[model samples]
Target: MKRLIATGLALAALAVPARAEEIKELNFGFISTESSANLAKSFEPLIKDMEKAIGIPVKPFFVGDYAGVIEGMRFKKVDIAWYGNKSAMEAVDRAGGEVFVKTAKPDGSSGYYSLIVTHVDRNDINDLKDVLDCAKGYNFGNGDPNSTSGFLVPSYYVFALNNVDPTKCYKRVVASNHEGNLLAVANKQIDFATNNTENVSRLQATRPAEAAKIKEVWRSPLIAGDPIVWRKDLPSDLKAKIYTFFMTYGRNGTPEEIAHAREVLAKTSDGWGPFLASSDAQLIPVRQLELFKAKVKAENDDKLSADEKAAKVKEINAKLADLDDQQKKLPSM
Candidate 1:
């Protein structure tokens, strides 16, 4: 519903955390990006940290790709993961993964934007509207379609505004990493692409040599950020430990650990610092985004033939209306 992409056989909570359980092993999942190194190193300290904080034998399962990791969660494979907002929503909805925390940088902000970028000197294309106009002549570059800022929300952004099919209208479309896609456009290989605001800015701030060759023409309004999640069935003691660990720990003392944490998380790129605790209410934006998307889809479905549109609209409007009402009914507090 929020951040997850696949379906699951629904399950509910096992129990609340009364006391930390004996952790024999802990499996974790993350996207395969250079930014994961921090969690790879500093995150292990958490196993040790938890073992000391509580009394248990702990391990960390570092898996690649958020989708597979989330899938594993349904069966209790991953103890924790950093899922983008959309992925998080789906995990909580399907597998009973609860949103435990959100990330932030050393700075105070909570989220980042998406950028529509082209090659460094492509003066001809400056905004999303322009990209749609050039869809017939230029190739579009995308990352893994499941990527958060990289693909999921950004793809929805494009689909929201236009009717063109990415596969057919563009000269070609290349799904590559944000860095790779940016490099492709800079090298004049691809015409346009999307990346994170934090990522684009970081490139300019930390690696100006490479950043100069890139130009951003279109950017998205801020969407809610990613979340750290756990299965609802996880024992409360373990859930509390997981949540507390993220909320309290900082890359302190261990400069090596801190540096590794920085590398793994790449907060500069994501516009979040280290992980911090968040409540379910923080996820309201994601649900709102779903509603926005449903609205757009409903509008587009209206363009179909009268009979087909009528049937689809009736079904679509029912679901969208339900979601919208859910948002409104949320407690005012």
Candidate 2:
């Protein structure tokens, strides 16, 4: 069975390659995050430029959510792609993907904040605990389950504070990407949700009418933003193509490249620009988030032996506690 699965994946990886010399099809996976079809349309020029630089035909595969897209990467269905930091870490851990690019603020920082939010009219909800307590019977929405802030830190930390199980404590829960989750809360379809301040600020700046309906009541500690990543097993030459393509594609970009880049970042008000060099360290927080989730899952599994649970639980708790301290140690600024 494992061998059959392996062969199936080997075939999927070839869905797209930069060159027929080493690959045929190049499938780039994305989700409803910033690069969803809504923006990918404007990016046709950009993708076309990328294809020219890399010398291959590239097709992007849109999956509705991050986990699905990341899973596709693991199964070799998606080739090159973007990932929220948490999902990126999981891909690298399980499927050997590596972070090759990241968005940069003018200051060269990769940080973005998570805002725990509720409808502006919902005054009774003052904070995360307030929502979890007063709205237990209400469905709470989550962005990508693998999102660093959207679902990871917010789910673990908020539930830890409220002493509740997100899976069982809430009357209902729905998963979507940043835009969908925010819209759900804004439209009063769910109790609350967490989104990056960067995204919210973008919407507010570009589409205030829609942003006006949402209010942030709680904010998370700093976290790294989403990243561009590719499977490490890809040929070294392919990595060079991807790396060089992004790094230099717009070096002396024609007005068209600059305009297209701006179009892709259209929603961000902070003026987030394109890729900059990023290291694996930028992903440690996300990996820690994955560990936190694994711990929670292990605690709830009934089939595991007590000894097994004990061992996993100990490791999980230690990492989470350490991460909490690590977060607190960062300067608030």
lDDT of each: 0.64, 0.71
- In model 2, the runs with Cα more than 4 Å from the true position are 1-21, 34-36, 134-136, 249-271, 292-314, 317-333
Predicted structure 1: clash tally: 27
Error of 1 at 270 (Å): 4.7
Best by lDDT: 2
lDDT value, residue 247 of candidate 2 = 61
Give RMSD (Å) of candidate 2 vs. truth: 8.2
lDDT per residue for candidate 2 within 1-333, as digits (tens), equals: 334334334543553354445676678877556546554664556677778888989897886677777788888887787677878887888866777677666444667888887789987788766867744486878777677778778877777544577777778878777777778888899878778887787667656887999998988887775687887667656666677666654343789976765554543333566567564556767767677667777887789999999999998888888877876776542
For each candidate in turn, the TM-score is 0.76, 0.76
Q: Please, what are the lDDT tens digits per residue for candidate 1 over residues 160-252?
A: 657656776777788875666776777888888878776676566656777788888877778666677776767665665565455545544
